[model samples]
Target: MRVLVVEDHEELAETVAAGLRREGMAVDLALDGPTALERAEINGYDVVVLDRDLPGVHGDQVCRTLAAGGSRARVLMLTASGTVADRVAGL
Candidate 1:
């Protein structure tokens, strides 16, 4: 499966991508929201492992844009926040 790992945390992003790659999945990395969007446009991904907080653009906006643009990839949202609102907002 093709996966896109979007995260502003460099180490975390690389770590996640490496793990996915080890699982025999095709993986790509995006460090911020705009880059994520661009990569998603240029590549057809089966899943998007998206960080809920991102630079360049917000993750919520990124998700909305992807949906509005008809991207069929399923989004697996992640966040560092433990707040109820943040968790609910991700969905």
Candidate 2:
């Protein structure tokens, strides 16, 4: 499966990509929201792992924009902001 990881934390992004690669998945990394959105728009991915907070744009905005734009890839948000409101807001 091809996955796009959108994260501002460099080490965490690298770690996640490495782990996904070990699982035999194709992975691409984007450090912030604009790059993430651009990459997602151009590539057909199986899943998108997005951070809740980002630079250039917030991850929540990216998720909403992608959904609004009719992106078919599944999104699984990975964020440190673990709260009901935060999760709901991302959706």
| Best lDDT among the predictions, by candidate number | 1
Clashing pairs in 2: none
Model 2 clashes, total count: 0
Off by over 4 Å in 2: none
Model 1 clashing residue pairs (backbone): none
- Per-model lDDT: 0.95, 0.92
Worst 10 residues of 1 by lDDT: 82-91
Candidate 1 per-residue lDDT, tens place, 1-91, comes to 9999999999999999999999999999999999999999999999999998899999999999999999999999998899998888888
C-alpha TM-score for every candidate: 0.97, 0.93
Best by TM-score: 1
CA RMSD for every model? 0.6, 1.0
lDDT of model 1 at position 27: 98
Cα-based lDDT at residue 29, candidate 1: 96
